[model samples]
Structures are given as structure tokens and as C-alpha cells.
Target: MRNERKFYIDGQWVDPLKPNDLEVINPATEKPIGVIAMGTAADIDRAVAAAKRAFATYSQTSVEERLALLEKLLEIYKRRYEEMARTITAELGAPITMSTEQQADVGVGHLQGFIDALKRLKTREVLPNGDVVRREPIGVCGLITPWNWPINQIVLKVVPALATGSTCVLKPSEFTPLNAILYAEMVHEAGFPAGTFNLVNGDGLECGAALSRHRYVDMMSFTGSTRAGIAVSKDAAETVKRVTLELGGKSPNVVFADSDLEEGVADGVAQCFNNSGQSCDAPTRMLVERSAYDKALEIAERAGRQAEVGNPEEEGTHIGPLVSHIQFGRVQALIEAGVAEGARLLVGGPGKPEGFETGYFAKPTIFADVNNDMRIAREEVFGPVLSIIPFDTEEQAIAIANDTAYGLAAYVQTGDPDRADRVASRLRAGMVHINGAPHRYGSPFGGYKQSGNGREGGIFGLEDFLEIKTVHHPARM
Candidate 1:
């Protein structure tokens, strides 16, 4: 069935001024699934104008009212959870299993988390100066989400903006626009005020740049590559808008000799290959102690081989196709470069897995004997590719881990608690997982350096949507 092709603006689904339509492809099948009206600068201006208008009233909403709205959104979001999962699997090429568990589930989780956080949030606090310090909404926000974790990035930015009473204009990745459309439907059904949430489906150059450069947008929360994030920042700088970016990463998974080698290697491989290794925080770079380098490489190869590569809908399919033909080409070229650079290809080479004729599926690749200087080691290869680099001492491992321009996440596996603590302290990333630690949903998630600024999740996320105001009052005497 042909889905809605209009943009969601001013609480209504409206057609764009131009009939410039973009075909939405099902990456797994390499077929045209649907089409959406590609929004232009004029459309963005209309959406932003609506948001600015809505913010006049929405920003004045009390914390209790905003919390109620978030709770209602959570309920509505849960009703369509399965549909969102299916859309992600079809549009973004995420395995069906991952779409259900991590992709779609993260959207619902973020909404619920925002609801819970808003309930406990103290918008008005008494200061020592006897004046009330109020945290208010920061007006209209511009959210540009990536294709990797479509709904996850959207809700992470959307829920918080809503909870803080900031109206938003969302520009989801043109590559994976289906889930964003579904989300707009949900938002409409949930009965949000006109212009409280807007969705404009278009490419970065047209719709995204318009939102960034728009003067009415008070803040911009973008999740994508570091290169694109830099452009968004530069565009938004014209108005000096607040910009929150969750960019690329080449995070290191340090495997110490004193740790559980088998378990560590297994978890590291899973983390790197999960979501087809499109995660901004995927531990793609593996740094093993020189003493256990050979063992780590063997285990990593075995783990890579074990990852089932097939259709995303098939049961037990651990890995799926790359999101697009371009991504597949990029990954193949990088894999070829890794081989040319002398990084030994332990398992996979530069091509689709055997028997996969259609789709953008790639074999789970592992490159051992990798030095820190290789392209695969330095760059963010957003595919199922792992690089195993050997480190002689603890100091060398730390130095290698901190060499990347992106510092989003780091993984350190060590049996010794003291050693783990020491290593974690030295890492440059925003979050460090020790001994295969799992991420807490409520904890703040973000990055350091070029990995982008500000934080998401927990209270930190709420802070990004709020503006602090100090009320000057004479001391009560």
C-alpha cells in the first residue's frame, strides 16, 4: 500500500509546494517500498514557523501538564511498537530481531523514561539568594536523526523536547524515512497540539540545511557522521543556536591479558557487529594485550565466522545487509583497503557473502595484524567489520585507544577491579564499560571530542531542552 507522501506540519499532513518525491527503498529487498514528498527550504520555513508559534504556548506549560503529555505519548507509542519494528527492518535493513529488541524498543523506552524523569523533575527550585530559579523550555528545536538507529535517535531527542515543552521540527534521514512517517502518525494520533511536533522528509542539503539555518529554531539536536555534524554546527552558527550532536566513533574494546579472554572476545565481537556495526558507539577497534594477541585474534575470527549473515527476517540471522547500495560500496572499498594495507583478513573479504545474490548483505569481516594507522582502524566503518590491533603494555593500549578523533564509547575488560578502574579513567570517551558491563537506560549517554557535545538520556537529556532563569528577589527579612 502507498503510505502518506505529505509532510507533517502544523498538526496536519500537507503536500509540499513542489511535487518533488523521493522513493523509499526497502534495503533488504532492494525494491521501492514507498515514496515521500521531498521537502524544500520553503517547507522547513513553514514547519519552523508553526513550531515557533506553538512554542509561545507550549513553553509556558507546567511541568505536571508536560509529564501528562509524555505519559500519553508513551501509551500511544506502545500500541504501535511492532509496526515500528517492522518498518525499521524493511527501511533500514536492521535484522528483524534487532528491530524488535534494540531498534523499536529503544524508542518506547526513551519516551517512558522521559515521562518518568518529568514527574520527578523540579522545574522551580529555591536558591540560597531567596530567589526562585526556574528551568524553562528553550523554544523551538530542530532534530535531525540518522538512518542507523532511526527511531532510537528520534525519540531520544523528541521525548525530551516534548517533556521540556519545546516544540520541534524533525528531519529524519532520507535513507530511512518510513519509521519517521510512522512516528508522525503516532504523534498525530496522540493529539499533540498543532505544530508541537513536525516531520519533514527530505535530504540533508534541502530540508536539513533549512532547519539548521532557520532563525526560529532555538536549538539543534543532530545524530549522524562527524562530517555532517560539523556542517550542521556551521549552518546553525549563523543564528548562534544551541547544537547537540551525537556523532561518529571508532571506540576501542581493550582486552587485557588478565581478563576472561573467551568471554571478552565474544562480547566485543557482538558489540561491534550488532546493528551491522552502524552504532555510533560500536566498539569497532579491538586492542588486545600482546601476551594474548594471538588468542584474541583466534577468538575474534571464530566469533566473526559464527555471526549468521542472511535475510533480516530469517530466524537466527545475527547480521543483516548494509542500509543502502552506497553503504555497501563504501564498506567493500574499506575492506579492500584494509587488505591492501597489510591487515590480514582472517575471515571475510570484500564482497557479499556466498549465496546472497540480492540485497546489500556483507560478510562479517575481521582484520587481524592491524596497526593503529590503518584506515579500518582509524575510520568509522559503519559495517560488520572488526579490526584487531595488538598493544604491548597498559600505557600503549591507553595511548592507542585515545588516538581516534571520535570519543563516544570505550570497552575495557579486566578481571582486576583496580586495573579496570585505572584503564577506564584514562579513556577519552564519555562512557566506559568495564568487564562487559551493560548500559543502563537512564544513565546519561553522549560523547567527548568530535563525538559531539552535550548529553542524552537521564536528567542530562532534559537539561539540554531547558533554559535556566534566575529570578532576582530581595532577601526575605
Candidate 2:
């Protein structure tokens, strides 16, 4: 087992003041792969102090200087790209194929996106009224990321903070600290100034709360459950720090009768089951047009049942397992609720897939005849579970899609161009994918409602870490 009990603080790896070591488990093997020091409030304090001190100089860096560092970091990331993929596969139980294609790719893709965004950004702009609007770095940032898309969330928050000349302390999920540690090494090798970036490993209560509530921290960027996001917002409120969140979602995928039912439904199922359906914007709820709902159901059932499950060490397109037993239990209970609540268990049901008894692998599941109010349709089951609901009319489809508390992402499937545009406008989501269009890098990724506020990615992402100041010149001479 690897020993990674040291926290990255002040540009060096230091022992945690209180060595509450935690075993990092591999969900695929149900065994400890490594150990990490669970950070305490004091650890957070030390990191915050370092960040506070570093912000003085680091926050003054020119955009060109920051871009050079980012480019260097990207270069290092490319050199170690395969290692990142393998590490994600080993630690998060993502299949090697998926890890290499999606999970680890985000580290490079988002970095490049930020590099482009930074190049286009203007630090100062003069308004018609002769007022100079300056965008300056916010002070010390408290960044908390989730485990599902480990490097994705890290780059989304950390890169922007550093790109905009802000210093930050990161508290990645305790479940997946290894990747964050590896990323810290990359940042260090990129030659960023000491204390500009720090990492402390701990749970949400101790290390996370301390970082959120610290008076010296000027902003908090968190990506996790809505419950935890609310807690972070409340904690940051104590010090009146700016808080941005990317929280939970039960996004809807509306399949109209006009679209190719077979292709659209099958593709939707694959997208939902990708990452074992742990993605925040996964189309968990599928709303089918009633006229073609039966055909869509048949396609969805086959798609779900055909989703392959395999070991993380394998190099195929199969999904591996959940990150932990806790996540497994949550997904299982939600699946059980679907059966108990009268939703048809159309495909794979609760329990590990056959031959996967040792690990925390959940069978890819699909539920048909589900209502909008059903637990399967309402909750964000971070597993390979998809819920299908049928609707009678265009208005009803839009209503059902928009009824959810989450507005992170919504999908529209229709051959009619006008209808696609109309429904896309009506749906309440930050991002709407029409006919399986993928979300590219550099576009804003966020949601409208309880899915959380503020966007991440590209220029919008950089804005989150910056403070806008308008300097007014004296009356014209």
C-alpha cells in the first residue's frame, strides 16, 4: 500500500499536525490501496495561512505569466497522462477505458480550455461613461471538490483560481485524495509559487468546514451534494465570503415521438449509465412521448441490460464499481424504492451484477412506467440507474422536464427543428443537449435552480474567482 499521509502545504509535503490516518479503499477490490492523513481544523488553518501569505505576490501576477505556468502544467499533465488514467482507474474503480477516455482526459481538456479563455480575457475595459472596469483576483479561495469526477472538478476550480491570479487551498473528497495529491505534484512541477496552491485531505466536517468558515478565505467553490453545498454556503455566510456551488441534479431527457426512438433512447441510456451514472448532469429521468413510449421503453431496457460491468483493471468499455460501499448502499436503496413504489423494474435491478459480489458494483438498472413523483425519478441516484416517464403532449413534456428541483442539464430529442428549439428554450436547465450533442470544453457548465449557482469552465469559470472593480476617472478636463 502507498503512504500518502502528507498534506501539500506551502509548496511542500508536510505531515499533518494531527495524524488521523485514513485508509484509501479501492471499491473494485474491497481492499485498502493506500493511506492518507485525514486533515484537522489545524491543518486547514496552516494551509489557509500559507495561502493568505502567498496571495500577496501570486495575486499580482500578469495574465501572461499565469498562462505560461498553465501551459507548463499542461505539458507535464500530457507527459503523465496515462499515469493519471491508471491512477483514476485504480482509485475510483472507473474502467481503464472510461478513465483514459473521460475521467483523466478532463485534466488536459479543461486546462486547455482555461488556457484559451485566459488568452481572450481582458483585465481592464473602459466603459462609455469613462469608467475603467478592472477584474482583479479575489483573495484566498477555499476549494472543495467531489470524488466522482476527481480531476474534472479539481481543474474546474483550481485552474480558474490560479489563472485569475487567486491563491487557494483545496480539500478534495476524502474518498479520492490520491488524484488530488498527484495533481498537487503536477502543479508543483509546473513551478507555481509556494502557497499559491495547497491540498488538505479530510471529510466535510472538520477540514472542509474550517476552510469554509476561515475569515481569511475570500471565496469558496464547492462541488458535492446539495445538502453539503448548503452547509458550505451557511458556513461561508458567517464570514460573508463568496460561495459558488455545483451541486446535485436529477436532469430530464425528453424524447419526443418525432425523433428516432431506437437510436435516441439507446444513446440516452448509454449516457446515463456512463460513469455508472454518477455524473451530476447524467440524464437520470427520461420523459418519453406517450405515443412512442412503449418503443422507447423496449430500447431503453435492452440498452440498460446490455451495459457491461467489469473490473477496473481491465482495458475495455465496461464500467467498474461505485467509489465506496456507502454509495453502493445509496444506489441500492433507491433501486429498491423504485420497485416498492410501483415503478416497473424493466431491466437490471438492485444488487451487484452476477460475479461482482466482492466489489461495490451495481447492475445497470432501468425503470419504466415511472411517474415524475417517484423516488427513482426524483432522487439523484449516483449509479447506473435510469428512470423512464411518459408524457402525452408537448406542453406536458416540457412541464415534466421542468418540474424537477434540479436544472443542471436537460436533453431534447426531436427531428423537428422548431420543436427542438422551442422545447430547449422552455426547459429550465443550464445546458440542453439536442439529439445527443456533447458538451465541449470552454462552454459554461452549470444549472438554473437547486443544481447550484455560478458556472464553471472557460471564461465564466475564471470570473468566479475574480472581483470586479470599476474605477471612475475625474470629470473630463
Candidate 3:
């Protein structure tokens, strides 16, 4: 079996402080494909020390110097672009095309965005009366990323940290370690200063806790569930380190009666099923006008049925198995919960997609006549499950969409520009997609409420890792 028993720390792959073996399962095959060594708190100490050491010199790096390294990374990433795509598909069960085109491509996109920002942004700003203001790297960072959209999450945090001259101790989700390991090799290959970037693999509590509580780690940037984000904040409070989080989203897609029914429903279904509805910003809750609710259900059912779920490596596979049995069961339990709460399951339910059923594949599910109060509508299923909630008016639709504790994303669909504009402006979300527009590559992305804090992407992403210092120059009286 392929084994990754060593952690990348201090610019080299080294054996773990203690051996704790964990088998990495191939979700599509339901078998052990590889093994990784789970790390202990001691491993985190060494990684943190290395990062702290690197930050002393790295933080003083010229913007031009950092840009040069990133430029090299962009080149190396392109050379191994296909390899990264295949690695994601093998470990995460993303369809090969999705992995290649979007999943892996997102990393390349973020790196390029950071590169452009680095060249354009001014690190130091001169003020009137000889005063000056500057943005500097916070310090060593603890980057904890999720399994869903692994590389995308990694690049958003790591690239910005490096760009701003902050070092990092990354603890990627245990579910997807190989890709992170490969990415570490890329960082190493790009010749980043030893300890500027490091990777430690382990379960959330062990390594995650260690990194979260580390005194040397000056900031914590996390992307995960809302519950976990709260925990990270509390842990970081001890050191009062900076924390930037992009957490859970039960985002709403509002479809007015004026829009093309077929097009809007199909787009919403495609998004909910994209990455098997594993995205934090997936528009799983579709709020439709009551007048067109029935037609929307029929359209949603048709769209869900059209999704071809199968082997991830095969062509035309729109959906694949959930990341692991634990995730599969979580999605299944939520689907069953929807049924129990009186929401009509128009398409799929708690079982695997009809085929040879050894893997963790989940049926693309759509629920109709859902109420905003229903458990299924409130909780994040994190699977290919869509809940359609009907509303009477635009105000009510906006209200229903904002009713959730999350405010990560909201969508608006309308043929009329005025209504789309009005409704979208009222939606309480960090990001809004009007007319089913896709997420822009370098735009600021994050949430408003319980969804978590701080923006990631472009200059906003880099700003999160930086601390502002205004050189007084004696505030002119």
C-alpha cells in the first residue's frame, strides 16, 4: 500500500514523533488504497517552531521576492496540473472532469490572483505630515482546511500567508491527505524557504487542537463547519491569535416566477450536485415562488435524475461517492430526516444510486414542498440533496432565505433586472449570484453571520494574514 508516514516540516519530509497508523479508504472502491500516519501534539510543536523560525526572515521578504517565488510556483503547478487533477480524483472521488477543470483549476486560479495582487498592492502607504502606514505579515499561521475543495482551500490560505510573508503549519483534514502531501512537495519543489510552509496530517482533535492552541502560531485560518469554527475561535482566544474562518453554508437560490423555470431549476440542481453538494456555498435551498412551486419540483426531479453518478475516473460522471462512509451516512441520515419531517422526496432518498453498491455513492436527492422550519432545510446535509421551499412574495422569499443561521451565499434568478437587483440587495449573504452567475475566481469570498468571518481571495485574502501598523511620525497636532 502507498504509505505517507512522514510529515513535511522544516523543508523536509520527516518521520512522525509517534506512529499512529490510519488507513486511507478509496470511497469509490470501498477499500484501503493507502495509509497515513496520524500525528501527535509533539509533531505540531516541531512544526510550529519551524514556522516561527522561518517567520523571522520570511516576514521581512520584499514583495518582489515573494512574487518571484509565487511565479515559480505557478510554473511548477502548470507542469504538474494533470497530476494534481488525477490525485484529487483518486483520493476525493471527484469526477475526473470536475477535478481537472474546476477543483484543480481553482488552485491555479488563486495563485495567479495572488501573484497579480502582490505586483499591484503597495505594502507601505505614506500619509500626510510624514506619517506612514504599513501592512505586515501577522506571524506564523495555523492553516486548518477541510476535505471538500482541498486544494482550493489550501491555496486561499497558504498562498496568501506566503505572499504576506507569514509562515504556516497546515493540518489538512484527515480524509484527504495525499493531495496535501503532494502540494507540500510542490512547495518544496518551488524552493520555498524551509519552514515557510509545512504539512502535518492527523485527526482533527489531535493535530488540529495542537495547532489551534500553539503559542507560536500567530493566526488561525480555518474552513470547516460552524461548530468547528467556534471551537477554533475559543482555542485561539487563549493566545488571542488572529482567526479567519470560511465555514458552513445552507445557501439559498431564489427563483422568481418571471425567470425561465427550466433553466433556473437546472442551474440550481447542477450547483447542488456539483462536488456532490459538498461545497460550503452550494445553493441547496431553492426558494421558488408559490405560483410556480409545483413546476419547480418537477424540474428539480428531472434535473436530479439527469445527473450520471458512477466511477469518478469515468467520463460523463456528474457525481461520485461522498468522501467517506462517515460522510455518506451523514448525508443519508439527513435525507431520511427530510422525509421524516414531512418534506416530500420528489426524487432520491437514503440509499445508494442504483448500480453495484459497494462504494459510498449517494443518490442525488430533491425534496419538494419544504418549509423553512424543517430540519432538512435548516441543517447542512453536505451531499447531493436539494430542498425546495416555496414562498408567496419576493419579500417572503428573501425572508426565508435569510432565516437560516448561515449567511454565506444567496442566489437570485429573474428575467427582470430590477427585481433581481432589489432582491439580491436585501439578501443577507457575503456573496450573491444573480442570474445564476458562477463564483468569480479572485473575488472576496466568505460569510456574514454564523457562516464565519473574514474574506478570502484577491487582496482581501492577503489582508487577512497581515497586521496593520500606522507609523505615527508624531500625529501632527
Candidate 4:
């Protein structure tokens, strides 16, 4: 019965100019949990105007002042930590352990990472010829984030924009707007100048499109599907503003025969099944060498069985329902396509995980003997779906991994250090993981190719919100 019908504008929770009632459903129980007032173009116009006004003063703030503001935000975020965890679990259906640990924790991690990175940044530097180069905040940023990792995406965009002294107006996914609302509360409490941060809640067609196409929006940071990213880019092109997109991936996890069989295969499976396989960088495709393909299949099946799909609030539950019925149907269709196209279904299939009936639950499915051309292998089926393809040699493995339209991420598992380096260098992706290595904290993250443009995370994320200005004057003594 929670009803949040206001948009945060000019540092206040104000009602939308005109509201459309939209329901937010809990995926785990297939129940309507809350309602929100979806914003219209008028709301976007108001928020963008507020942000543009604030940018005049906020963008000129000293780095030290911006750093102070970040410290306050981090402090306030920690105090409201449990609320963050609960909001994500309620809206996202992330298992309690994961919601509290990984999903919620990533927001804090990015906040802290930006604070640390900002401390080391040199805002101004002198060239050998005594010309001064300055990094300046790109005015108002319109941030459109997805539902899968709400807080992570929100913080990645907002913190950097704040740290670099850029005012922002955010349009979080209509499916998961609770956490974003909570975040706006935190920003207000932190006492940022009026209009430093504004939030407009609505779908891509209304609020998102309005913000992206706004002429006053100096930059756009979008995290979502490839189709939507392309749409945002097209809209932003009218203004010729800088746009950063973190889109889809059918990323490959290549496992060499010389690697540890049980560890590599099990880890690959776990990575694929993590977050119910909704992650953009999830290793959905595992390319195993011919000598270890069968063994990898056995280990992958075992790992999939080990992942218990049940209540998201339960203590040890590892998998939950897809975000909505639409997502559930999408995943189901891909599974059916794999069957018709003749990819060997190893475990689990198109139906909900056993013991559940009404929820948008999906069985953790795995397909072996898959070719790179298969629909399941080529498309980003964002579900608990894994495709295992076998390769005969190192060259073949690289060729297979690099053949996708996505270049968001890739993985490699090998015993030989030199071979690992060689394979990594040949892969066409923004981020590459070696032997299931954890994600790098401050490393630049984004894609090449059709995956999207620009980077986010650490110093790179800050730079994305900044513009370079060269001052050519008298040499400094």
C-alpha cells in the first residue's frame, strides 16, 4: 500500500505536473506492492530547468567542497543502509543475503570509490609549454538507469556527477523506483544546494525521452538494453550532447583444457546463474575446449542444482523470479527457441522452478553442444540461462568469443599465465575477467563495438561527467 506520488525537484518532493498511476509489482509473489505517479513531459521540463539553474553555482564549486559533500553523502547512506537493502529486496526480488551483501553494498562501494578517486584527481595541470589544462564539469546530466541493478547504476552515475560538480536529473526505471526515491531523500538531507539533484519517475517514453532530448541537458548517462540505448543516443544527438551507455552483453567465458576442471566450470556456472542471470556482464556463454567440454557440463549441471530458487527473503536462497511477467515471457521464449534450434538442454527448461506456480520464476536452464550461431548464444537472453559451446583450439576459442555483436565483457580460465594474457589481449570487450577474478573496484567499465560508448567507474566515470578546457596564457614562474 506504499504510494509515492511525488517527484523530487528543486530539493523538494513535489507532485508531478500531471500524474499517471503506475503499479509496481513484487516479482516473487506476483503481487502489486506499491504505486507511483509517472511523470509527463511537463515534469521533465520543470526538473531540467531546476537542474540548469543549480548548475550555475554547483559546477563552479571548489573540488574540496564537492569532496566534502561526498563524505556527507557516504555517511548518510550508511545510516539509512537497512532501508536501502529492504527497498531493493521488495522491488527487485534479490535474495535477502544478496540484497544486503552484493546489491546494496555496491552502491556504498561506488560512493567510496569516487570519494577516494576524487582525492587523487588533479583538476588542473600545466603542460611542458606552460599552457594550463583544466577539467570542468559538463553542465546538467540526465541519468536514465535500469531496474536490474538499481542502486548500483544510480550511484555510479550520480556520485560521479556530484563529485565532478555537475547537477543531475534522474529517471530511474519505473519498475524499481522506490530505492531511487529513498536516495533522493538522502540527497535532500545532505543539504546540497536546491536543484543539485532532481528525480522524475516515469517510463522511457515519457520522462526518459523528454530528458534525453532536452537541449539544456549537457550529457546523458544511460544504463539499459541496446535498443533503448540506441534510442537515447539518437535523441541526444539532436543536442549533440555527450552520451554514455552501458548496454547488453552475451559475454563469453572461455575455459582452456589445462584449467582446473571443477573450479573453472563451477565458477562459470555460478557467475551465469548469479542475479538470476540478469547482469549485463554475466558469463552467459561458456566456451570450453574440446578435451574438457563433457567434464564442464557435469560440473555446470551440479552447480545449477546447488543454486536453490525460492523466496527472496529466505536466508540462503540464491535465485528469485524474473523482474516481471514480461521478462519471464522473454526468457521462456528464448528457451523454446533453443529447443527448436536443437541446442541440447542439459537441466531445467522453460517453466517456472518447481514448487512455484504464480510468480515470474524461471528454472535455472543450461544448454550444451551450442553453436555460436544459435539464438540463445547470440542474443542477450537476460535470465538464468547458460549456453556451453566447445572450441577445438586457442585460436578457435578467441574467434568464437569475439564473434558476438556485444563487447561489454568476457572471461578466460587457464593455468598458463602467458596464455591467459594472450587470450585476454585478443578479446574485444571493455572488461575481461581472468580465472573468475572478482570485478576490479576502480577500473573503467563500459563496452566497445555495438555494446555502447564511453566508460563508467572510478576516475573514468568522473571524467565522463567532465569536459577538458585548455588555457593558453603566460608561463607560470
Which pairs of residues clash in candidate 2, taking residues 3 or more apart in a chain or in different chains?
none
Which ranking of candidates, highest lDDT first?
Answer: 2, 4, 3, 1
lDDT-best of 1 and 3: 3
TM-score of each: 0.98, 0.99, 0.98, 0.99
Q: Each model's C-alpha lDDT?
A: 0.90, 0.94, 0.91, 0.92
- Residue pairs in steric clash, candidate 4? none
Model 4 C-alpha lDDT per residue in residues 1-477, reported as the tens digit of each score: 788999999988898877588989999988888999999989999999999999999988998998888889889999999889988988988888888888889878888889889998889998998888999999999999999999999999999998999999999999999999999999888888999899999999888899999999999999999999999999999999999999999999999999998998998888888888999999999999999888899899888878779898886757888899999999999999999999999888988877889788899999999999999999999999999999999999999999999999999999999999999999999999999888866788899888888988899889999899999896554
lDDT of 2 by residue, 1-477 (tens): 999999999999999998688999999999999999999999999999999999999988899999999999999999999989988888899999999999999999999999999999999999998899999999999999999999999999999999999999999998988889999999999999999999999999998999999999999999999999999999999999999999999989999999998889999999999988899999999999999988898888788778899988988878889999999999999999999999998889989899988999999999988999888888899999999999999999999999988899999999999999999999999999999999999999999889999999999999998999999899884
For residues 1-477, what per-residue lDDT tens digits would candidate 3 score against the true structure?
Answer: 678989999999999989899988888998887899999999999999999999889988899899889999899999999999988998899989999989899879999999888787778898766778899999999999999999999999999999999999999988888889888989999989999999999977888888888888899999999999999999889999999999999999999899999999999999999998899999999999999888988888888888878889887757889999999999999999999999988888989878849889999999998998988899999999999998998879988999999999999989999898898889999999998888887799999999999999998888899898988775554
Stretches of candidate 2 exceeding 4 Å from the true structure: none
RMSD of each: 1.1, 0.8, 1.3, 1.0
lDDT by residue (tens digit), candidate 1, 1-477: 456589999999898988887788877889988888898999999999999999989888888787766777778889888898888988888888888888999887777777777778888898876889999999999999999999988989988998899999999998899898889888888777899999998889888899999999999999999999999999999999999999999999999999999999988999898988888899999999999999998898888889888788765647888999999999999999999999998988898888887999988899999999999999899998999999999999999999999899999999899999999999999999998897777688999999999999868899999999998887664
Query: After superposing candidate 3, which stretches have Cα over 4 Å from the reference?
Result: 474-477
The number of the candidate with the highest lDDT is: 2
